[model samples]
Target: MNFHLLRLASMALIVGTLAACSTAPVSTVDPSPIPELLPHGARAGQPAVTAAPATFAKSRWLPVTWSEVPGFDSDTLHEAWNAWLKNCERPTPAFAGLCSEVRRLSIANGDEQRAWMQAKLQPYRVEASNGNADGLLTAYYEPQLDAARQQGNGYNVPLYRLPAGFGTRKPWYSRQQIDTLPEAQAALAGRAIAWLRDPVDALVLHIQGSGRLRLVEPNGQVRLVRVAYAGTNDQPYKSVGRWLLDQNLVRDATWPGISAWIAANPARVNEMLWSNPRYVFFREEPLEGLDAQFGPKGALGVALTPGRSIAVDRQSIPYGTPVWLSTPGPTVALNRMVFAQDTGSAILGAVRADYFTGWGQEAGDIAGRLKQNLRLWAFWPRHLTPGSASN
Candidate 1:
């Protein structure tokens, strides 16, 4: 759901100081954690985000062809299918009827899957209400960092859990306020679930919303866990990168550029951190077994597929929808099937989308730098009211 700050996304957090964030405070957090050791089921106090209706999204759906979808026949269907299967976990009513058929086709070959998709689903080229057929496409990935169970040995940056009365507060505490205020510190006492070696990494975790933390316990043993989005202080997300750019502090504005600026202006790190004011709290989930291999669960409550999952404006393309994303750009030439399984704060607009490129360094590299023009076709089940699709 994010990429407005992908440059150092693995290390950066929050979107630009948008009008909302500019006037308001900055953001703080994201979703999912390991299930086996710390299953996020029936949690005692955690809140659930109730999704709203997508019927208000006004996008024209013009009939298209498989031929229009570049590389449609060549994509590894099995790879995309994994994401599709996850969507089935919480499919929209439109797709719920087709899950049985979807499961039956799970083991089919790429060619068969392609054929089945073409046979069963109708392609609707998604166009904006203004009749624009193209939009921007960016990338985001899961960040991995080393953390500690305690705040000693320079691992002082604390990743907190939700504090009491967090729901009652309009906006929790900003990065600076939280760090400087005694009451804020007192509220967060005993709530530090984990600690990170670098404050920047903690910032990255906050920026990315969720992260994979390889934590070192007091026993000198290391274990991996997902410190996922528990809740934010409810502050609007403000981009630290954008703040740096507006101040003429960084010219490149990418992750590497931010890193250079941090190195050269080490004294200003807190300024950068506090400029956006948003802070994210996390829920620790164990990352052993199969959970270690997949990405954090998306808004759809499904494990996202690397390179095949996308975060969209749910208002435009509802969750569980399959989209044929074609974008010819310098950073990445992408023509593949992606599922709308996630949503982000910055991924607004009918034509906009954020591509999830999987985990680790390579995914992080692509997420930070890849931004391109996009054309998309959202496929729907054919039997839904044989009539014109309206914008």
Candidate 2:
């Protein structure tokens, strides 16, 4: 989980009592962080940040008013209720008391739900310790792709599961090493879960962590299944997109742009794949096309809500917390309540969040193009008797 923390109420003073014990008691209270307001130019497509979003020097939670959250009231809170319910399946002990109430409120109207929030939760705006509220918001999604039950013809790329003794050593094998080395190939020889045509498609699936694979069996029968994250080779993840950018080969850095570059430089595909030594393995699960609509389960171990689920740095925001997010610009103007249900490698920083854009091509389009400004307001249970809690 992302490290997402606090204090107690003052002791009441007795009035008109023996009071020579005076000087107004210089209490050593650590000041609550003051929130930073977003700049006027802040919008959806680009960040209006005062500095680099990733330069993250320091960050903290600053208590904020619900009014300061742009679409707090107007938002369809009920829309995110399902996401909240999913959170309860493995909620932190601090939120145990409110799960029942949240379930009940799920069936209520928006205004009624709004009332519940107003009464039960307090908003804390996430900001840099230096007072920068503006940060970057990218997105991720589940992608569905075609596969072959047996390797042949146009379908030749193999997506393998962990082979025996693979985890015994650290940094088992890099992507290029796995493809070229006999030892690595031996481990995966008889363990091909499925095969695909484009190496890039498999790479995309690996990056996303989970996806639906439409398999064409030996008998020409079609089957759909999910490939969930199993394990990684323990190597560091390198950004292929960044490599292309640094090489001056792609002007637009989105997925589409990268795909176009790949098509032109087909011979360099392995180079791009090798750029990231990190390799992920997967385990297949049964999934029909219709069932895939609900979205694959996220890091929270619960099915994600489309457009309502988000991936935050587990170090900053706990897996099951609810967040009020507001980030507007050219791509999309989002002011809604989303659950922090997942986390990612690239998603780092206190205010950093990745909007879960759901599944398929459309969601992929949004996820690919999304690189905008973001701000967050975390809603925590008021009755949470604050001593210590994940943020």
Candidate 3:
């Protein structure tokens, strides 16, 4: 799954396709097309395919037939039922009524699930205001790293909790200021939940938003813990990889490429780290029982399903909505059902999404290079009127 050549080749093809399409003639028809809606009980026997445009904060949704969704019949719908069930934990107002049926279908077969979806939902192609149906897809995952409860044994980089008066300060402190200033250091003095050996590993934890830590305590006991995102310094996120690319320090900006550059030039590590002013804080959570089997709680306040969950711009697609993701790729061909259960600072736009690839080193490797072209279709409740739900 971590094929660099495949990623590069696919990206090149996507870019070429985009370039060729850019010169094509534009359609004169209205971009935001409104269709007639049927009464709730009118479609008792068949699926409703036409509905008013589902308007959201930043995007529009036009109803389309289920057949229009690529790979609709091929995807293993039952595999995504777990994610759908998770969505029930914090169902959006528009989707609240369907939670019971969603729970009931957890044990159903793929055909049964697909049939239920067709009976209860309408498929809408997600689009921007200008009617662009294409966007970008990226991936993210949880990092699992070893750590020490106390600062010793070469574990100098500390993972801190939010400082006192964190909210009172407008922008808090920048990463460089936190690293160099005594006042900033004092504020976060005893906030360390664990200490990591490498600053780059700490950076990866911050960027990924959450991670599992193999903590070695004072009593010589070992345990696994999770550090979930609590807050940031309110500073903008700047990509260190982008910084390296801009400076011509590396041909590739992925983590592997960055790590190689770091190994070669250790002296300039601080310079590279400080390029991104934002610093994220975390709160520890126990990793046990069923929680250990699942990923971190997403923005929707539910555990995310690996390969079945996606982070989207809330303005475009509301949380709890089931999405059909399609991408023609040299990296990975994904035509499946995924749920909108998370949101990220970088995930913005009608069609753009960040696919959650689960945890561990293998997941990290896949996530780091998963940038490609994407198209999305939202499956919404048939009874709910489009443009009526509050995002």
How many clashing residue pairs are found in candidate 1? Answer: 13
lDDT of 2 by residue, 1-391 (tens): 1110000000000000100000101122112222346442244454332222222234566555565667666676776887888888777776767999999888899999998887887666667777767777776667678899898989999989887787687988888999999998998888889999998787777767777787898899998788887888878766777777777887766555777888899899899878878777888888755455566677777777777887776666666878887776446677778898876655677788777776677666666666677888777767553213553
lDDT tens digits by residue: candidate 1, 68-106: 555676566776777788888887788888888788889
Say which candidate scores most in lDDT. 3
Flag clash pairs in model 3: none
Residue range 1-391, candidate 3, lDDT tens digits: 1111111111111111111000101121112212223332233465655577767878888887776677787777776888888888888888888989989999888789899999999888888988878888877677789999999999999999998779889699999999999999999999999999999888777776788999999998999999988888888766677788788888866555777899999999999989988888889999988788778888788998888888888889888889988776645678888998878655678888887777777676566557778888898888887645635
Which regions of candidate 3 deviate over 4 angstroms? 1-48
For all candidates in order, the CA lDDT equals: 0.70, 0.68, 0.75
Compare candidates 1 and 2 on lDDT and give the better one. 1
Model 1: lDDT of residue 212: 83
Which of 2 and 3 is ahead in TM-score? 3
Error of 2 at 342 (Å): 1.3
Better-scoring candidate (lDDT), 1 or 3: 3
Q: Pick the candidate with the highest TM-score.
A: 3
Query: How big is the positional error of residue 254 in model 2, measured in Å on the Cα after superposition?
Result: 3.7
Ranking by TM-score: 3, 1, 2
